[model samples]
Target chain A: MSRVAAFVFRRKGGKGWHWTDIVTWVWLVGGLFIMFGPAVWLVGSSLKTPAALAEFPPTILPYVTQKVSVEGFDKPFDLYEVTLDDGSKATLAEVRRIGIVSQMVDPKAPGEIIKVNIAQRTPVREMSFATENYTEPFTHFDFFRYLWNSVFVTVVATLITLVVNSMAAFALSKYEFRGRTAAMLVILATLMVPLSVIMVPLYSIVSALGLFNSLWGVILPTVATPTGVFILRQYMLTIPDELVDAARMDKASEWQIYWRIILPLTAPALAVLAIFSVVWRWNDFLWPLIVLSRKELYTLQVGLSIYSGELNVQWHFILAMTVVTMIPVVLVFIFLQRFITTGIAGTGLK
Target chain B: MTIDGSGKTGPRVGEIAMAPVRFAMGLVDAPLRKLQKVAGLGGMATFFLLPNMLIFGIFVLLPFFINFAYSMTGGSALFLSDRSFVGVDQYARLFDCSNYLDPNSCAEDTFWTAVGNTGWFVVLQVTLMIAFSLVTALILNRDLKARSFWRAMFFFPVLLSPVVVGLIWKWILQRQGLLNFGLYGFGFDPYAWLNDRTWSFAAAVAVSIWAHMGFYTLILLAGLQAIPKDLYEAAEMDGTRSMRVFMRITLPLLMPNLLVVIVLVLIRAVQIFDEVYVLTGGGPGTSTLFLTQYIYETGFATQLRNPGLAAAASILMGVVLVVLTLVQLGLGRSSDKNGGRK
Candidate 1:
């Protein structure tokens, strides 16, 4: 073989680190940052104060170099003191109180100041890096209530979908009953029908069923996902027939076979479906937005939109809220990412 | 003679009955003997399909039929009061070449314009997305260390909800955003990425790619893996160049996956609503006004009671999608089954 040909034919595994390998490593590692950089920026900025967040070139780590200065408060008298261990206050008179003007108050204030807009509660005196972005949602607002409501709906919807779809998939896969092909066709063909066509009517149906704004509102419509059933059925078909037959020989019922034998074998496939359902439910914005009207019942995605107005957006708050909201999904993905990648690809094969 | 005939018939009948009993007993020991030879089949089929059937029927089948029915009516809240049967009036009004009654009492040209914009977006976004994903997948699939980690990194963006993706990217592209900050560092002037009409559309498409190309990448990677490595080795032995190998082997083998990805992406891009809704909100004078978002605006966003119009628009969009999806499936199936051989 020619030298070039020999080099090309050489098994890649045995090739010690070469120029190509080094370039590939750089590209791969750099590519990781390219993919995750925006997300990192988003989550990082979320933890920052509005001023720190607006800093040019953007800092990933907390800003320790700059102390934020607040101005424009009418009252400026100062004699700041913190009591030492002796319990006698010795004054350090140079420090003065500065009130940062929140967006809630206008610059053209005084007459425009509404009683409802005032920050009546005492502000935190400490300057420190904290998880207030997360905890504040729990303490200061009904963010937890919204989160609970979202969780309740998503969990219920996903579980119901899994059960119903799995059963359907099982029936379609295993049975040679009448209209079997027709039933499968009906399920598959519906995949093409755009969800927009049914949004209005589905909304009307939910209202008609008296399920609007209730947990049932979210759960009922999403149950029995044809896609899920299709996936589960496809997965179930891969199971060996003899395993099921052995169970039948032991006088075990069909349900017993499903619960004990089939479901266990399908765990890998089910894990994939679980990730899909969780991510989809967690990120679902439109359907939930349509179904839910009450602020307290809003999902994280929907509630986050309230901070996003027609024109003006509070970037700091939105980023903070976004970071907070992404936590559960990120955690879920981290735990189940492997299953997620394998499941869809594997299921798609059938 | 009569007694002889009766004795002969009885003897024949008794022999036949004994034969049948032996056959029945022979079958008794087998597991499925009691089940009419298809024992668990009926029950098991029901278990597999029952859930999907129920859900699909209620959510999918029912909605399809309902939309078909709604398409026939003049279906606005106000029009509901009129209660007049307008056979194909809505679909007609959608394409009525003359001045249809706008609330402003002027000519409203919605169909052609919306169709034009949607067509452009579908063509642009789908092609870009597929090309982007395929290239990325090819690069990633190359013999490299830490392939799994890099794969995960590329695929991570796919995990983000479109809504969240829009919100995050919007921040990045905002006037005082990271983009501007970075530009300022290099002494370059900041540009309006999402605010300008042309740029807004591009920005929307860019966001769609960022949010979803990972999915296509996975699909393409799978396709790449399926290609026989032996083919590449054989080509190399014959002194076939790298580019030639890619063109001849890789591209052709990857066609099936490419078709699927293209079709899926096209259909999805045409119906895109969430990202545009979050990012530009179909702004800068409707430069980024996609058909789905247009329907949304007419129905929900604009606070106008033109749901009838919105419904009409949605049905039209659905028709377009259905046609596209059907064509894709038809072409895709035929190509895979026969194209390579020919």
Candidate 2:
């Protein structure tokens, strides 16, 4: 009887084990899908034309092609034959101007239109899958100039930030002066005060200085970021004082010490800070939006917002633009990842 | 370590002997030695700091004073000639200046509402963000395979622009967005995530967490790695369970980092604008209208051009931020002391 009971218990245990193993596998797959699914969709959507994007069910890949329109308008008016009394057929351009629905285009079915109106589907017309979104701007159907400006601003800003921030950090870290603590405290204090607090005043200052609509308008205010100063100073502090003293004793000038001794040693930290600064300045939206009034001066972020405006947000173009904007940041991140982990760990600084 | 003829230990002779005669050099060298001890040894410190000081004064300090002055006067959008010297009246108007057009607009209510909404946003976002990041950090720091890959995956969100974050999440959470599409597929009714009054507020808080978790994770992971391995070994030898070990050892050790992360998160959460702007545009109703957004609309939005009110709002926001920072720093200090004791 005891052996019989033991056998029964063993059988139940085996069944439970089998059940849990199946459940665990299901959960593992489900969790990963949930986490990485959006990233995969973003990449996939960028390759899709408007027709293929976010259609009723998401597609596994972007494989659809769109038809081109070529045979619409040779003569201005075919009115008399068609309408008799009115005799004037509305030209394609005139129809478009008066908000008439296109003849070839289907007026969305009532149910579908309601869903689209409710924000389910973004209704950008499908176009041929060319890289025109990346190149064409004269016709203004897509982005080209805004991307160029973003690249210019990012490269210029990153270079300037590295030099200015490193210099300030070197001074703060190596020197022990009467106002050193006070200066450090002030920088830290700025971290607490958000830019929103002084944005109006900042705008007024920029306007007064006549920097509106210029690249310098965006670049100048951010040159003195408190966060950069904090990061650089902390990294510099970990450098031994003896090195500077030794360099000085050898008759190396302060500038020489900064250029040769200190700069070389802090390369890893500087790289990390550079990545931080570049990514931030490149991706900045608000300040750039306010400073650059001219459409031509808009950076990638602000331009992307304009592309997303309610009247005409071309999802395909927007996604393509997103891909274009993200590529540089992604490449920089991959390059900096090796140094960044150490920097973040606080080990590299010391 | 082989030394060359010049040697690495001391400065080369010419650097020390820039002056003419040996007699004058000796006289100059003695007093200069004392000057070199404190600030940048000798004259080195003064010159290196000169540029930084000038920039800091002009950009940071001078503006700080100006901000205070503007707060005092009823600052206008117009130039100095058009400004008036209404001392403290501007500050008073902050509470009383309701409908600039309507006599009964009740300005004080709007200001107070903004304050309440901002506070709620900070509380919800900071707590949720810290929780998400701490969990991710703990999981990533575990002695598991593919730890590095997971760490990289988790940290990727921080690399994206906040505007991108806002936009991506906006696409997902809009009334008929991916969330509803997914839900519909699963046979549930579609929920409006961005347009509903309550859901809009909640969605903003959620976006702040998703965007910020990576930075906090990095900070916490550093703190986690700093804990010595011996403690864990000892806990195991004493037959303590994993949960007990984490509670007794890891929690105490990680407190300093937690304080840093918390304070930073709080400060950032209060200043959230980019996500708020791109997501709902503070819409449906005033449900998602954050303080910064309110100030932005007042000062810059095409429809609402109230520079004086905006300035007052900004000054008020600044004061609140400063006070909150001070309080957090104090709490952080006490917690740090407790951590040291453990």
Candidate 3:
């Protein structure tokens, strides 16, 4: 057996498969499918034609309904080539525009058109991708503007969150001050206060600050997240005091030491916070929904919600927009999956 | 004054005269130096914490008190100056139920309905969330093929925006959606998944689990990986059954994570607004309306836009959440203490 196989099947009974192994593989594969099926369905449905989407038995693959020109018909129609009684192939066309009329044209005879009374035409399921679903939303709505708003908000908010949070974390973790414990406790206590509880007052505060309809309204209030501070603080506490002392011995000011030494040493935790901050700011819906009423200021999440408004829920366009919105976060997750998992696990242990 | 190369050791009369001028400069710097000394190391700490504290004060701490005050008032006004103070009346209205058990008998039927719905949602969501998450974690922790790939697949949805998760599932669970299509292929009748009350609530719960189970799973997976290998090896050596080994060894060892998952899921399930709101719009006769949605609709969505009553409702939620979070923190602390001892 190969080394990996040996390791995998190393459950005391030498290098062989166990029942548990079979069960585990089966469960894992099934779980993977269940977890990913909806997303896959979303992408597939977005690429499907309206007719295919409305089919009784939904098609997983996107299909295009094409019109083919028969020998006798000048205009192209959706027709199926059929093998007649005598083994020669003829084209069957169902023309529904002028009542249900079926026409059969002999391939051998260029101009022979025979009217056939057939109830149903043979169904042809062709795999086709509607790339229009991706472009149609942009054509009709200001999707790019929403995209830009999302990106701008995410970048600015994440940067502010990192700087504010890291500074606080550094002080709490590294320094000895009169109110250090009290400050940490208060910060941790704020974690219990859900945003929903403070929504009304926070809204008023934003309005009072004259940031009501601005993206800054959304950005400012969320820059100093308590959870970000806690996570970074936990990670920062693990760093040795010797590093800070060494920097101080080199005549480095506290600010200089923090800027140069602490930030660099805590790069992994900072990266984790950056990832989370981006995701949170990018995906934030309710606050932005309340704050940003103008079409110009809507974030991607809000824009996607507007796309899925009550009267006309264009699932194709909505799904396409959802897929588009997920691209950046998905990219972030892909690049930093290890860090994210480690960060989460680490926090949990703490 | 000492010269570097030319070794002049003593101060001349001109140097002595300049010393007085320098002393005057020092006199000028006296208060500034004293201020710096007073500020000192603690001053640096204060400086580092000031920006975060300022923002946190304005946004978090201040709003907390403001929300309490708003809850005590009654009006459609956004500004407190325009509102009338009606102490506890909003809470009274929320609590005024002819039959407290029956939400329909309540004065504010929608709020009561939301409360009742959230109660059920939390119970069901947390239970299923823990079960599914634990199972997924356990399965993923095994020495299986493509382990990280499976882990990523499960964790990917957790990274997605709740809106995206809601939209994706909403499309899939619609009347002519993928679920219906699958059923139709098997010669089953199409069900209006989102339009029906029970199915809509169920759909909401299922989607909530789908979106978040990955996160809880990751936590539990960490817990599973932390279990010592020797215990499992000893169990195997004694030819212990797999189920018994899991129940006795794995489950018992994983209590901390399980508790964390439970409390976290409970809190999250209570605060579920984004997914359920987008998916069903608290719809099919308010079946899926949660507490957060109730606060949002009351404060922002309705024509009344009753911020006061919404604030009251939010305060009620805040109280419950605060208690739960305290319990969670306490559990975490106790667990940490225990772990430290071990």
Candidate 4:
């Protein structure tokens, strides 16, 4: 609240804001609306019933018409305010509509039908969620399978990426080995070579290896990311040489030194890389789209996109699933936002 | 065995949980030490680097070369043996245009359309993105109340997956969607934001900026804060106008960061697919079709899948990306060299 007040009036040690301060607030508020508004609307629309979704000049909140179980009706009757002949309004339960007239009954006094103009009655509505929108897809579609595929890809791929990339980082940073410079150059050189550029031949390679329609096809191809190795190597470089030297002095194997000393020290970098890998794998679409032709193997991203393509009639479900898809990453961001931001800033990693 | 004699913090609960892990590692340590005695440290380093390099070589490097071969071949076959190389025919087909500007005059009209669209998208999206990012950064650099709150709010969109970004916007911008609904409420006729070519193209640019501007804004904000305060104070003492101070001091120092941001945005812009793909679906008539989506559709989605042509298109796109990547690296190196001097 004070922030709102500050936006309104705070500026330059004066009681009132300067024009510049006003402009700043305008920008901030506009940013808030442009950035935050859509996500909020998505959540709201996801809860709205299909009929509610179709309304012209849509309601800001999800609203379903209020219904009441009258004393003698098979189903609950929709309640509405009816303008009587005397020009007074009373809430009544609507029974049947025939052209321009509606038969409504007062729940308190049953068995008597009051005829009223359909135009004269307005349906009473209450803000409510259609949780069926969320639950319905699970009973019908491969929602859980797609979710598991995404999680499986994210978790397994991230673990493999960590182990593989860190081993490379360990080798490059700790040793003065043959072709070290050449290895460094090769990795860094292809940093900009995204999967989109190489999908055609990469597909061929994966297919040739008989990994088509397999999660491993998606998992194995993108594990050795250049950016991951680069970020980890730079972080690993900062660990003191004395640790490795002492480990060697104790007659520890090189593998032991890397696994015990360097790996532990490189945890912060590994966390950042792990987070990056999780996001990359979770949101990965194009490569997986090419690899996994089968529906059961679709990740959440691929699944969401497939549904989105045919969702002219299924917006509510798609909206709910999109919200579901966004949960893990957003949760990670919320908790570790500062950590992630500072990590990127310090490393200048993109 | 390595001892934990360095500086003990406390109980080290995490270490305790990791006891079995280290114990297992100790078992391997003996065999590995024997292997190292036979092979030496250089060979161990090679062993460590081998797995990562093998994957990188196969998937990334080898396919990069194979991409060239695929471009030269004129067949729908995924296997190279099934393909016959008609040297540069795919490239020739791509260039089989009488006029460059009029995509309709070209043999591969859709390819040319995609090229034109991607070029325009890169120019427009990158310019507007950097401009908005700069403005937002400047505003947020102010010691505002709930600064972190505002920063996080701005960055929130960046965290969303591209598909989510697309769906959110699609719901808003579709006919009878939120925007139109709002317009109808305001006594104005709702416009079909996506159906029309110009508006949809504009929307592609706008939505891309909305989704990605936060990242650049955060980058630019860091750059802004990194500028020395005393330089600004010195200018203020000299009673210079705000614009003049910004032009003189802010821009020159912000150049390196701005350059990095520009290249990053440009690179991403040129490779745009997923968001715009889901948002416009290459649109009412291919108006929003860009290069990446063009290659994807051509290679995979289209009924008459032309693998050779798509490969050729991708290789051309790769050349452009390679140039941009080189420029980014050049800027990075130059900035590093000038770091001490600055």
Candidate 5:
């Protein structure tokens, strides 16, 4: 074991560490590595050149290109200019390495090859950054468009979710009416209906509603999630009813009460709902994949998936895009982690 | 309705100036209040709930019923009018098999293959997930150094998109990827982690567990925290061994969360699609083709695009989910009753 592992297992005289403590530390550290190492590797690999990425005994760090002199083909091959038969200088287009000879091609004259002595030529190592892996995808593909689509869909869907679910929750919790229990039960029951079951018919419905190939097709179906209703309802139940009665005495309309009084009070719950909603809508894939036939309408997830299939699989580009796609959610999680942890635990218990 | 002693009872100049506006408001309110009186609070409640119920009814409830209806019909059309009614024929086709034990003997052999693959997936995924999550949760519940940071590290992947998670793992597990690179370093030949059938299936399950174990661990951690500290203290006072205390006290107290985790994990395992779809595309001869992927491919991918058969398969999936959910609710109820007794 390494020094850190030894330290982890080490026990002081008074504060003696038991075998279980050592076991626990080992499990925790191992589990954390397995959970977190891939993401770190992803970010690292994204920064490497395609050449360095394909190198045997693959490296974890992005390779820094360094220029070095070699005995054979001593000059930098890419920058070498060849002398043409017509006495014109041509850029070296291709270099092929055989047993003891090097063949260089001049693009200016495709049919002619110039032989270079390997032992006599000076080859220099060229080391530079592969920032192009990050830039090429955006310049060549519709990356920003996908990013914008994701933002729009996530924001609109979350706002609509908060408004609609909170309204329903407000009524369900604040009012006693016939079939109120039944409606609540029905809504809760629908939570059990996994998206897989209703997906086909839901597709048909969206098609029939003339939303095919539209971002609205993706946004509309997810606006009224049962989990949102359940969470907001549970929160809303804790708000004192006397406040609503006081608002009623002020002759505030029902809509006014919901909009001004209840919604403002449920801000914390709304924040939690907003975070969950944004994550769900942003990370959503299958629905958008089905609804968005047009490439321009594809969200980040679908767009990244399409990028995955482009010609050859470019691991560097894919990793870069994955990092790009994860930034927003990570920021959100970091900012509101307290709410997320508590909200999830709360829902699980309930 | 009474005014405060220091407050003015009569309308101010601004209010008097708004008399016409108030009259118009009163005209609107009169009919609304009369309607409220006639229909009562339930009617008002329905009004408040209309928007949510309308969307939910259209998207979820209606589609749920239409899914069943679609399963009973036969055709490839997206519209119901273009299809013909075929009672239970789709179900019959799904269950049609020569040897029930062998998926290849079935007419819809891919469906049975999916069923078989998912069965093994659920078994392995749920078992490993529960065990790892429990162990991790218990460790995190300890008074260790950098405890919060370690907790966040384990929980971070749960926040990632499933597609991203799948892609990350695919990059790591591919033939020339990191795992094989590590093997090469150790003087071992590269193993085709995803290209092979068995390894691909196992990779799918392993990836699922990695992506989701955090959420379940958090649940288990919460359950662990909820276990009263006094119980452990009492056990300590009685000179109970740590192992005995864990077995007798912690395990029993954690049972409710454990049951919830099991059912949730099972349901999610059955619903596994995005990660596996992105990672393996249910390839290498349908070894990792889950039921959800089966439904998606049957309805969307193939040229035939058989909506009826897909609907039937989805309904079958729904049946399993509903049963699991009921068991979850039952567990919740029993736990609640137990809490009440205590």
Candidate 6:
């Protein structure tokens, strides 16, 4: 094979390195930071206590101020290094304060309290990962319920979508039938009609059906995706007609032909559709937000939005929940990363 | 089952896993055969097609036509019959601006602002997204180590929910957020990145690019790899500069994929509601409110929703989308015929 272009691969120059490799290295490293840095920082911030989160210049790592209980004090006193008015520094536990002065006591001898201006002391701190940030939401918020609802919607919708779309694709691609052209045309024509366009009417119809605040309400409407049928139909068109004919000759029913012969043959495309469906259903917001108003039925996307969108926002909890909301999709991407490019190119949906 | 011709080696893992599926199909097989005998081949086709058609018709096609009816009627009532027929009054209200260019002069000023914001957003976001995607695609297309890994890093955000994407950026851009914290550490004042109007709008575009550029980059990378190596070799033999060769060969070859990316990004950019909604909440005096959010706020979020007016705005948005779709189909047709527009 001809050598790869110098431009495409790293090439050694007479000196240190080629200019192109340097630029590419810088570009990749810089992109890695810009793309992934915010999220890494977020994980750090989420692991911080609420007070740590509120700091003006927050640390890159989570840290909490140290507190110590002195010999006499029943309550834990915040430990701080304080300078006395006589110009001596000592580690003292904070006792109480009046106005700007903070009353401090040495741990060994807690009888006497020294009053120092707040600015004259620095609080001792230690690095601590706030695991409670991740756990507290489970008890305090509807995060787990939201997660279960999202999982239910995504899994059920994808399964139904696969069955329905594959059946439609099989009919369109494998058989000659009445209204086939019309049916196919109708599906193809509405390919670009996103839910945003017809949301108000769809909402009315869903409400009329008494599916308001229902998970099935979110699942059913999106199952008959035009893109799914289109992709599957295009894939099934490649299968030879003789397979179906042979299956028929073997006395197999039409359903059998569809289930055994065509379905298995169309597995790669199905995998793509399944991946596509999972991501779309998992990440879906607008439709669920419309249909499921009750908080119990709220999907992760809607719940995460409500959490972050609130006034007097709880940053630490929101941060933790946001991390939870995104992890599944990211994990899905990593596992199915190979198939996703094909999924997008096949359907042009995303 | 016999036609599968794979029983020679006994039951494989797939066949074993599918045992229940086969059994279930067997139970239905007799009835289905009887139905096929009664209804013939045409009926079988109909059977296969009906479920999808039923759902597609009810959810997608039916609502689309009903959307027009909703637009034509007036009132907060959702069902078309409950509302009185306004017959284009909603459209008229949308167009009732004294000066269309100045949203302030319009009676429905928020609608105009949303339209204006969507317009600017589509222009800036689509343009920059394409440029950045192309550059990233080119860089990734190079015979570099860990190419797929780098590609995955970019594509990962595309998988994130718009809400998550929004919240991630919201954390960074909020006052006392990480971005501000960094600025403060450098002795700079912590700026309210999301609160300022100009910065908020810019953030909307940037965050949008951040979320979606990976997908387009993947498409363009595929296009880049598809270009024959011989063409580049020929250019090299002719002593052509890389820039000149890219303009002469690479650009033309990648045009079709680039067109698809552009149109998709345009359609998506116009419907920029969720992330920006979470990011700015269309805040700092409505600097970043796009078309979808306006319709959503009008039709649902408000105490008294004006479905008629919202339907009209969405109808207008639909028209724009239809035009974009047609362009894609047209370009897609030509692209298929020649493998590229040229």
DockQ of every predicted complex: 0.21, 0.23, 0.30, 0.50, 0.33, 0.50
Model 2 off-target regions past 4 Å?
A1-35, A63-142, A310-312, A347-350, B1-44, B97-105, B108-110, B189-192, B331-342
Give the TM-score, chain B only, in order for the candidates.
0.78, 0.78, 0.88, 0.92, 0.88, 0.92
lDDT of 2 at B263: 78
Per-residue lDDT over A1-350 for candidate 6, one digit per residue giving the tens place of the 0 to 100 score: 23565455535453456676677899899899988897888778889888898887877788888989888668998889888889999999988888899988899888887889999999899999998989999999888899999999998898889889999999999999768898888998988799889999999998888887899889999999888898889988988999999988998889989998988777767766777888999989888988888989999999888777673468889899888887888788777776676566445666
TM-score of 4: 0.94
lDDT score, residue B31, model 6? Answer: 90
Candidate 1 lDDT, tens digit per residue, B1-342?
011222333334333423443354345435433442464557555645665666677766776766655556664553233434566776676676643333123233654555667778888888888877887788777876677667777778777766678788888887767788788888977776888888888888888888887788877887798788999999989999777999999999888778877878888888887767778877777677777766665655666545566667788778878887797778677766864674
DockQ of candidate 1 compared with the true complex: 0.21
Q: Is candidate 2 or candidate 3 better by lDDT?
A: 3
Can you tell me which runs of candidate 4 are displaced by over 4 Å?
A1-12, A69-73, A96-99, A103-113, B1-27
On a 0 to 100 scale, what is the lDDT of residue B187 in model 4? 88
* Model 3 per-residue lDDT at A171: 93
lDDT of 2 at B330: 85
lDDT value, residue B8 of candidate 4: 39
Winner on DockQ (2 vs 3): 3
Interface root-mean-square deviation (Å) of every model? 17.0, 8.5, 13.2, 5.1, 9.0, 5.1
CA lDDT of every candidate: 0.67, 0.66, 0.81, 0.87, 0.82, 0.86
Over A1-350, each residue of candidate 5 has an lDDT whose tens digit, in order, gives 69897787566664776888779877876876787788888888888888777776676666544432323444533434445556665445335778766687554454667775455444333455578888998888888899999999998887778778987999999998888889899898988887888889999999999998999999988998988898889878888999999988998766557766776666666666777888899899898988898999999999888778663458778888999998887897676565577667777721
The candidate that achieves the highest TM-score relative to the unseen native structure: 4
Off by over 4 Å in 6: A1-19, A83-89, A97-100, A117-119, A345-347, B1-26, B340-342
The fnat score for candidate 5 comes to 0.54
lDDT of 5 at A348: 70
Global local distance difference test of model 4: 0.87
The true-versus-predicted C-alpha distance at residue A19 of model 4, in Å, is: 2.4
Please provide, for model 3 over A146-253, each residue's C-alpha lDDT reduced to its tens digit, 9 standing for 90 to 100.
999999999889878878898899999999989999999889888988789999999998999999999999999899888889877887888899999997788666
* lDDT for B112 (candidate 1): 55
Q: For model 1, how does the per-residue alpha-carbon lDDT over A132-163 read when each residue is reduced to its tens digit? A: 66666577667778788778877777766766
Please state every model's RMSD to the true fold in angstroms. 14.1, 10.9, 10.0, 3.7, 8.2, 4.6
Question: lDDT (0-100) at residue B259 of candidate 1?
Answer: 81
- Candidate 2 DockQ, CA atoms: 0.23
Query: Candidate 5 residues B1-342, lDDT tens each?
Result: 111221231224224433453455456655666667787767878877988999989889999999999999998999777889999999999999999779989999999999999999999999999998999999889877787677777878888998899889988997768888878988998777888998999899899989888889888998999999999999999999988999999999999989999999999999999988889889888988999999998998899899999999999999999999999999999998988998
TM-score of each: 0.79, 0.77, 0.89, 0.94, 0.87, 0.94
